[model samples]
Target: MPGFLLNLNSVVICSHGGQAKPTVPNPRVRVMGMPVTTLGPPYVVAGCANPPPPVNVGPCVIGNWVLAALRVKVMGLPVLLQDSQAICVPTGTPLTVVLTQMRVKGM
Candidate 1:
């Protein structure tokens, strides 16, 4: 858990939305390297498959970067954010490093 919680909800006032034009990239906290036991099954919301593709798949839910980012950070550095759910990660603590560390420990 991080000491601070980041609110992704923002209003940029763009002429268009979607990952085009401004195309503000959503920084995805890498969970690809996390331990399998903790990663949990592919998160499925509103009956949609985990990480549903970008398409008009009817009204449904999808991955929440804010939440995922928090999870990744917490799993990587539980000590850093002892009493928090999520906050921006410290400089240089990338997801790859965290997953590598955990995997090494497991082996």
Candidate 2:
């Protein structure tokens, strides 16, 4: 699916509402004056309210993007898109794409 490309300024969050920040943004490419995000590095999550006890497993701490643009590449790696899928570590949940730059679109 073609969608807006994810950039450094993109707003992403874990399923539990934790903010997710890309560990490394691709400096080789820029979108909307911001560095584009690739599928290589993990996204660190913070401020997750998921309880860490018997009630639930734990809060989402990290997000690993498992899917990205099929044809878009930055430094030979796939560029992340607004519809990209990511899995949150420990919690085994997903990351949500809240906002992404609409200037660039990719598959």
Candidate 3:
């Protein structure tokens, strides 16, 4: 599916509401004036509300993007998009794409 490209400015979060930040944004590609995020690099999560133990083992601390644009590439790696899918480590929860650059779209 085609969707807006994800940039360093894109707002992404884990299922538990933790903010997700790309560990590495591709400097070779820019979208909406920010570096575009690519697959492979893990996203670090912080401030997750999901509690540990009895509540459920969570409070997601890291995320890995497993899916991304099929056609868009930055340095031979697929670029992440608004529709890209990611999973939080340890919790097995998915990341939510809250916002992305509206200027560029990719499959």
Highest-lDDT candidate = 2
Give, for candidate 3, the lowest lDDT window spanning 10 residues: 25-34
Clashes of each: 0, 0, 0
TM-score quality measure for candidate 2: 0.97
Off by over 4 Å in 3: none
Q: What is the C-alpha RMSD of each candidate to the true structure, in Å?
A: 15.5, 0.8, 0.9
What is the lDDT ranking, best to worst? 2, 3, 1
> What's the TM-score of every candidate structure?
0.18, 0.97, 0.95
lDDT of 3 by residue, 1-107 (tens): 99999999999999878999999999987877899999999999999999897879968988998899998898999999888998898899999999887888889
The Cα error of candidate 2 at residue 26, in Å, is 0.8
Clashing residue pairs for model 2: none
Q: How close is candidate 3 to the true structure, as a TM-score?
A: 0.95
Model 2, residue 16: C-alpha shift (Å): 0.9
- Across 10-65, the per-residue lDDT of candidate 1 in tens digits comes to 11111111110111222343223322222222112232222323643232222212
Query: Judged by TM-score relative to the true structure, which candidate is superior, 2 or 3?
Result: 2
Better model by lDDT, 1 or 2? 2
| TM-score of structure candidate 1 | 0.18
State the lDDT at 42 in candidate 3: 95
